[model samples]
Target: MPKPSAVTEAPSVVGSRLRQLRQRQGLSARELAHRLGISPSAVSQIERGVLQPSVARLIAMTDALGVPLAEVFGGPEQRDEMPEDLTGFALQRFGQGTEMTLESGVIFRRVSPGRTPGVDYFVSTYPPGSAAHPESGMFRHEGYEVGTVLSGELTIDFDGERVVLRAGDAISYPCSRPHRIHNTGSVDAVAQWLIVHPER
Candidate 1:
């Protein structure tokens, strides 16, 4: 038998973050849904992480909440005290960044020391045979993603097309396209992801 992959299960923090921001703004779920032009159940699903929001919806959500896009992804301090100068810099040591796991069993480590404008950086690890979406399904969001495989193998499926990548291989694509990534190899796969979001 083959050895088990390094990753097992990972959980996403998006729902928690959404809930936190909503409460901070003193908006109830129904009120938020009304502002977003979505149903209350839809808002519930998003806040519960049962459904992921599209890029456009995410922008509308931030606008409704009167917060920057980075506020949604940043820690409490970063959200509260976002620097106005992009030139300001900080360092993040190995294993020191914010870590999260998605429902798909992928581990994500935020690489930046704190929230920066325009982009979100992450190091992701996928377990063998694991996928970002269910088989034949896909997920779409906002922004552009650039990634390179660091170890094992990664398979990206965009629409009906599939591309397999080995270590050192890289890919860049729009997040608007329906897509998913899978660990097709028999070992854990690690990759670095850079997601660029539109300026607010």
Candidate 2:
């Protein structure tokens, strides 16, 4: 098989990170999901990055994994710049998102089924004042997660208490909390996330 390039290597690296963390904790996907207050499917999705997890979800995953920001985004394989064409895969950008009721210029990248992974990797943007809620009253995450806010104001919601985060603010939270994310500034919000899960 041909060796994957650096850009292609990132998702796998991210996936591997999650798998390793999950193994360290000796937890199963279903078990982690239960602990994170989300469904196993969601856990699977996060591990694959087929879905963009909210800032709230990232915190929950990081709490579960017990790792720090540098471990997630600063990991070696992720150091490559995003691909110009990205070959066979594609990224979708929208003014609206599925997690919330309004269009907020959110950008999402589909990681799994589209790309091979040693771990999950995603690049997403949240416009100022854009936020995400649990689907139809459902909320929560599935494992230890981490996030690096790239721009604007990020509001991390833990139940009703809110943590207003700005550029360069990093966070870790337990997935079991009722959480949500909102862009509370006048500019666009961009962030990268990593979530880990037990090996399948």
Candidate 3:
């Protein structure tokens, strides 16, 4: 079997929507950068699609803008426009979902057709040597994650303990733990991840 290739193209919509959100929040690029502890030029680069932020940075950006991460991916406005299905179901066709390739070389594609209150469903691809937290090594949030490795190998580090997962393996853990996801294999590691956010 052939190894899955890395997804290199990041949709420009993410950048544009982020910019719109920042502007709508009445924040200048410099102010946003200050809040993110990054340079103004870095913010501009990300907003213009010249640079792609790592997942951590993107999350911080959205939080600083007083919006949920989903807002960066079309948000409630887009979700509200989906064609109604009295049958109570909708489909998220292949390539129709939002895709973003981070600077760490990880690709996150939202797979859920619409909002699932406090839930996030997505496919994540981690290229060889890539890590969810490239610098910090670990981070924690308010939620829980359940994921299964579709291919390649991935390692999850919780504090000092490390758990390795191979293709077809699955794991579930609380997001409150300081952890990091790393691709330790030579091939791209792809997984379907579901995150259930803590109630607000």
Candidate topping lDDT: 3
Give lDDT per model, in order.
Answer: 0.72, 0.55, 0.78
TM-score winner among the candidates? 3
Consecutive 10-residue window with the lowest summed lDDT within model 3: 2-11
TM agreement with the true structure for every prediction: 0.71, 0.44, 0.79
Q: Residues 3-120, candidate 3, lDDT per residue (tens digit)?
A: 3342334446678888999999999999999988889999998988988887767767876786656566655476654455434666665556766788788988777776566777
The C-alpha stretches of model 1 lying farther than 4 A from their native spots are 1-15, 24-27, 30-74, 80-82
What's the C-alpha lDDT at position 49 in model 2? 53
In what order do the candidates fall by lDDT, top score first? 3, 1, 2
Ordered by TM-score, highest first, the candidates read 3, 1, 2
Off by over 4 Å in 2: 1-104, 110-118, 134-138
Model 2 agreement with the true structure over 26-120: per-residue lDDT tens digits: 88988888877889997787677555555445546655665432234433433233343565453323421112111234544423322222244
Which candidate model has the greater TM-score, 1 or 2?
1
Model 3 C-alpha lDDT versus the unseen true structure: 0.78
Better by lDDT, candidate 3 or 1 = 3
Q: How does candidate 3 fare on TM-score?
A: 0.79
